[model samples]
Target chain A: MKKVLNLILFLGFTFWCFAQDHVNSENRIANRHCLDCHGQRVYSFVNPDDGSTVRKLMPVDFRVDSALFYTGAHHIFKCVDCHVPEYDSFPHPNQLRFEPMYACLDCHGGDDTYAKYHFETIDEQFQKSVHSPETLNGFTCWNCHDPHSFRINQRTGESIANTIAYDNAVCMKCHFETGSEVMLLLANEKLKPMSVSHDWLPNQELHFRQVRCIECHAAMHDSLLVAHLVSPADSAVKQCKECHSRNTMLLSSWYRFQNIENRNKNGFVNGVLLNEAYVIGASRNEILNILSLILFGLTLGGILVHALFRLKMNKRKRHE
Target chain B: MSEKLYLYPLWLRLWHGLNALFFLTLLVTGISMQYSDIDFPLVRFDLAVTGHNIAGIGITLSYFMFITGNLFTSNGRQYRINIRSLFSDLLAQGRYYLFGIFSKQIPPFPVTLKSKFNPLQRVSYIGAMYVLFPIVAITGWALLFPETIARQAFGYSGTLLTALLHIVMGFFMSIFMIVHVYMCTVGKTPLSNFKSMINGYHEAH
Candidate 1:
């Protein structure tokens, strides 16, 4: 009986090891196969009519950096998992190129594991955004976010400036210059350059460096970690007081993470001050303000008393 | 009888008037910016900022005139203090303001030709012009060009510290303006000192 048990245990252990090896081998093969074509700086092909070799540089959108992909959020996903299975065949059929792309919700939605992320709420917000499929044709989750390399940045303990740069870069990918080929492909029009559109802003460069475009452009949602409902340009926030008042919207949005981490423990009114931001009118101490007002009041009261006494004294001197 | 002395030069009078105008502008605009509310704004937000900046520049230029005038003229001598008699002089002046003035007692250290200011006036003027003004001016310029300010100092935001200092100095300056105006009423006539500032003269009774 002991000998039989040992044999069964040995067989089970071997099968487990073999399965692990096979899974790893498949991943390696898939990665190598996809990256082989997508990773090249330039793609070369024979022109069928002329029998001449033509070299063309790969577009930024089509090229994949292997290093980034292996470390990306969707690193575990095989190419066939997201792409058409028929893409496994060499010289994939031209019809596969037109296959409908997968939205983030296609895999992440309705899953118990991803429930905490509120994918449904995100979808709801996105549907109302300017980039919604009904509002802007061909716009998708992949337009702003590249699944090949998108990473969760704000919650990664990175500096606010780094997070701002990363997030703004995603917006600038489509919104930067007027006549770039990429802009034509994505926006399908000669979009106004960012510099011209934002010329009315004071300290525009500093603002761009320190803040994300979505801070002003997106419709704020209380439950959303980052607002997704991108408002139209005409509806964007233009008032300086929006971020410069005591009840600044920034504390609820761009500065939210920092405000939570570095909340003032010394009874400071504005928590954003501790994070090295001294917004005028917004970053005032309540204690100091009250003390100042009290002092001013006392001084005024003292002056009035002094004046009354002097007037009384002068009257008595005249009577005498 | 009252005698008139040319205590203020034309340039000094001009500087003084411009300084008062600019300071008032700064006071109103600065308060508006610091305590801005959307519904009940003291001044419109953008207008306050523009007005404050213009007034700030005006004050800066006025300060420069004051410094240059004092440096090249005998007016500078008025700020000098005799450290040995400082405490006693301050006490005398403090007592005069607190009690003697109301009781019709004669001023102990009256204004004179060689001594333009009383001991208390000298010390307070020195504190305001030499110490507080320089600090406020430097910090104001630093704020105007924020890139020059340090990102952090002593574990506090450097810009916050600068702004707080500016506000404190500005508060003290406001208090000084109030007391200074009231002190002018204590002259031979209530309007006599104001006339002296206008006509570059001082009246001693």
Candidate 2:
């Protein structure tokens, strides 16, 4: 009896250890340690170009919504992992800009790392993007995705709805409403209105909710990677055939954010990815459709010829 | 004068009407979803999805009703083809439609108590209901619950194959609908067969 009890106890202990390894809990307190000040109204700065004084609450000014941070990609990371020594001290010096504004390439730079998560191409693509060649001041990854807010392996387990909302929020942060840092930044540059009106797209809001704005605005290619280069408004994918054709971008966009293993050599974006929900033209099989159309045409022709023959036979019988 | 017979009983008529309604709705919604990006979609893409799902449920239920009704009634007997002469009879019927009918040759076989459907009709209906209909329905439901499909042995790629099969079968079913409607007009009077369907009576000439 004692031996059996020991075996059961050993099994129970092993199970507990396995469970602990699988469940990764976010260290929210570590974030709060920094937010305790950043959350309060303590920072202000005068814009050199616009002559406007920018003073606001720490979390709000920096666009750090704590609630969002808790559920974000970096939730599992400690604040110290990305921060510099200057940020560790209290009452940070006035001259200190955001210390350790880590660029995406710091870790995800080399070809090996980029092959895993192809953000390197995004940098190359951005140069030719619609915002290119003439932004009053240039921008980088941090302009759109703040390193603190951005998380690695972002879409591994996220819901499609949540993923879409998060993607659009990144773009709309500057483009939708005024008074946003992004808007202010764009305005300061003296660039054209970053805000766009996509009246032509059917069910515009639903499309916005279903897919990222970058999906259409970016350059077209075999891979789902959004070319960081924003296309000019006129160059946007205006022709429906671009997506409705046999090769559709909508079919592959969802595959881009997933693990690299999902892709294969046979030109399938998400190799054998079975979507529960259909995306209109995206689900159509061109070969099968063409074959069915040919069948329909032949059947129609046969019927018409048969009808004419019958008509001729009946007319002759009447004459007889 | 034509011989009047009460061939389509109440249950058969109900099943036929319900099947027609469901199939038409499924086709419209399915086509709309397939071609939504083309231009001026028949219905909004989201609404098309909603309608297709509802119609799919209706089809599933009606399909069950059809099978059950056939089992319980004499109507099921109409679909049973005699294997001994099936091939020859099918050929004869093919000739009747293509050459004999235009030449004013009389029909080889007429509707009787034991055989309501001629060889061609029987083979087509059996293949459609038993083979094609089930393939389309099973695949459609599989698509609706993709998580279940992913869990199965076939996994993700299997789900794509299922969707492809469903779409191809759906195309055939549409063609069947067109031919079936046209055949309805092939009776002595164009409206004769249509009236018989409504009143549960078929006239034998």
TM-score of 2: 0.59
Once superposed on the true structure, which residue ranges of model 1 sit more than 4 Å away at CA? Answer: A1-56, A65-100, A111-117, A177-180, A264-272
Q: Where's the lowest-lDDT run of ten residues in candidate 1 chain B?
A: B36-45
- The deviation in Å at residue A97 for candidate 2 is 13
The sequence of per-residue lDDT tens digits that candidate 1 reaches over residues A1-320 is 99999999999999989986674566657777777767777877677789898888877777988777766677777777888888776567999979988888998899999876678888999999988888777778898889988877755666566788889999888788564665576567777888899988876876887678998999877666678999999999898777767777777874765667566443335454556666777777777889999988998888889888888988998899
lDDT for B146 in candidate 1 is 76
- The interface root-mean-square deviations, each candidate in sequence, come to 1.8, 5.0
The CAPRI classification for model 1 reads as acceptable
How far in Å is the alpha carbon of A283 misplaced in model 2? 2.8
DockQ of all candidate complexes: 0.39, 0.21
TM value for model 1: 0.83
Worst 10 residues of 2 chain A by lDDT: A258-267
- Candidate of highest TM-score: 1
